[model samples]
Target: MTEQPVPAPGMFTLVLHTHLPWLAHHGRWPVGEEWLYQSWAAAYLPLLRVLQTLAAEDRSHLVTLGMTPVVTAQLDDPYCLTGMHHWLANWELRGREAATRRSGADTGYTEPEALRAFGIREQAEARLALEDFEVSWRHGASPLLRGLIDTETIELLGGPLSHPFQPLLNPRLREFALREGLADAHARFAHTPRGIWAPECAYAPGMENGYAAAGVTHFMVDGPSLHGDTSLGRPVSGTDVIAFGRDLRVSYRVWSPKSGYPGHAAYRDFHTYDHVTGLKPARVTGRNVPSQDKAPYDPERADQAIDAHVADFVEVVRRRLVSESERIGRPAHVVAAFDTELFGHWWYEGPVWLERVLRALPEAGVPVGTLSDAIDGGFIGAPVDLPPSSWGSGKDWQVWSGDRVADLVALNTEVVDTALATVDKALAQAAVGSAWSPRDAVADQILRETLLTVSSDWPFMVSKDTAAEYARYRAHLHAHATREIADALAAGRREHAERLADGWNRADGLFGALDARRFPR
Candidate 1:
């Protein structure tokens, strides 16, 4: 009799984390609402379109998606919807200007043909994006996401409000944030997520208890957090919650410091911009090449590169799964996690590559499923004690709490303590009441500002030196608001507190349903 062929090794799950700071009414250019609109138009819209198409074709749950409550709130906010629509219209106008204008040395586009081509492409993209927005996203993103979840096109992972680095938050505050964040999701989509892409994938020794208490069944961590053995999801000691490690070998294939698919010579250079169009039009000809020296981006060449990279990635997954399964004598699990924004926002062709990879993986005999599906499919391993870790530099908290951001760490602590104490005191003073009232607004604003102040983005910005000034300014701005509101509440100046809260709410308002009273004294 012929020997039975060994079944192809375990499955592959692609986890894409979608997050951004609350940017509805924040600044407009450089690092504000523009960031939100650009990503919305490029990444979210296109990625969702891909998933929806796959779902229609009966290929659902091809990837796991993580959308933090903060980002969800912004996506659903009416103000943001209107703003994004207007921004798309403006983008089309900018494209028109680029086509009509002449390029100079300062504009980075040396070739008129290249500039005109980029302009036409931009105009077409903007018009199509606007049409999509008006047809599908005019109401809000919640409905679109809800339909995807209902169809099981993706498993949604919710995160804490404002994406705080959980390891450093006070335990009570941590629990509060997690509970509230989950509640926000349920309110929006009518489904509570069981798995979360922890902000920064940061974890501490005792967070398992928090996960258990919050009813989370699983979460993602760095591969090194599991000592490089990512063949299965391990249960945290003494808890039913599972911790899935990202397979860095597969993930870094797409993005890494030294090498990544995005750096291909034919791919659009993320850093090189056409000043005339305010858009990128050059290929990454060679590393460290001057912007002017780069070659024009060719769509046909980039399409070829994308196809080649997708094949390479599928093979990487197959080899990893087969090797790990043989070593362990069972089907192994491989998860490739990446930030959702990296797709269309950072790498212009990422969404296309993702759609192709998802379709190609199963054809290559490697099945694609969500992290939850992996656990249910018997990829769970023996319980283990997880170390304190994050998916940051050195696989630790250095990116958020290193010496480079010591000042931010100190500032966060002060702001959180003050806000929690003041909110508790104010709640106690108020007479017992029903769900929400004016008495709760001060405490609500305090928590909102506090959450904003402790966002992981601040330290990340400081460490990376990317918009460090804006990050610092934002941190201090929220901290200042938190302190002022807390002080007003403490001084029994209810009117003053209301005014301060109102101004801050109008400026940085998100999570309108947040109740500060849920926090412990």
Candidate 2:
């Protein structure tokens, strides 16, 4: 018999999940709205420029971008828009201050005020970001995002309103959030999303029914979530909805929890900051070296590193494609999903590396496209009963539901149970003879706080000890907000309840489309 040729090697899809918890009216210092503005400046803005540039060259379906509804609400909010503008101006102001700060001759900074150049660079970046924000993002992200869609440059993924961990959530609330989130996508993009990033790539058996109910056709999960067999998108629970697993082997090449391209000696040192000037003046000279001893960052060397890494990444993808196809006895699909903030935020040279890798892949004969394209190109495999999983530590739900966060697990369940019951009871009373109505303001606020209380960020932060204090504070704050409103509703204090709800809405006021009456009975 004649030897059979392995057809097309494979394809690759890149998914970037963009999200930040609500921070419009939050604090500004060590953490709060600063998180929002920093990411907006460092990651989202620069990354958009790269994608827009690629689109100008007729690059279509380049990547799948997920912006949770909460992020959408913040981006479009008048309050956040005003705050971001001021934040950009402050950044520029800081850059000027850095220009005046001189380093001691005793320090290794060789030249007097060697930070002057870094300060100048910061000023230029701030000015560029200011212009970008004022002209392009002033109104909202939708218009700018729409430009990408209009040019056929990307696919957008939508998720639940607040990024709650679904497996631990009440099914009714889960469905409600799912449907409302898609509705949000329609409002922003003029198209109802058929796919979601599934809030941390969290999945559980039978969750597909809710996805199918909400009209979601596809979602993402981690590699181990599918038993490490991630060469194709698998259907879930015999439904048309597909679950695509991230290829960790390929993804870790650019970024992983422990090591990646960002750790290169040539890259700007993320941890070494010039305290006075608030700038990173050093490069990654050595992992164990003190911040002051690190060498000054040289842009030229970083550029070389970016090119070499991009070439290496392109080769990795090409080899993975050919080898995986041969092993699977068919064409394969390699999906690499990552946080959008990783580029430019955590990894300074990431956006450049991203553009280079994206451009290089196709030239190297390793195809690249969005998840949607992979599906249309026939990357679907047999249906699966995917176990409960997440993209968190250990590729399991332990990060959100582990011994460390057992208190949070209890708190989340408590708030959800109370808020749902209270809302249901309030609605029933209002339907019969109460002063308030089913779409009452107090009820909406209760649900809002409840949802915020269960955000995956809180527990994950707690588990990882990353700002665990702030995480606990936020969780308790929201839970208390829910309790206050629920107490007022129970006491039949309509006027007091409305006032309480109004006050809460001032800070947490988002999702105007979230109708309390429409919530499941």
Angstrom error of the Cα, residue 381, model 2: value is 1.0
Of candidate 2, the 10-residue stretch with the lowest lDDT total is 104-113
What local distance difference test score does each model get?
A: 0.89, 0.87
Q: Pick the candidate with the highest lDDT.
A: 1
Model 1 regions more than 4 Å off? 1-7, 102-105, 431-439
> Tens-digit lDDT track for model 1 on 1-521?
76643446798999999998877666888998999999998899999899988889998878899999988888888889889889899889987776666654678668767777777888998899889889999778899999999999999999888999999998878988899999999999999999999999999998998999999999999999999998899999889999999999999999976789998999998898877667888899898899888998899999999999999998899899999999999999999999999999999999999889888888778888999899889999999898989998899999999999999999999998888788777776673564553548878989989999999998998998988998998999999999998898888898999999999999877888898767866
lDDT digits (tens) for residues 37-113 of candidate 2: 88888898898999999999988889899989988898899988888899899999878766666663443444335
Clashing pairs in 1: none
The lDDT, on a scale of 0 to 1, for candidate 2 is: 0.87
Off by over 4 Å in 2: 1-8, 104-112, 433-438
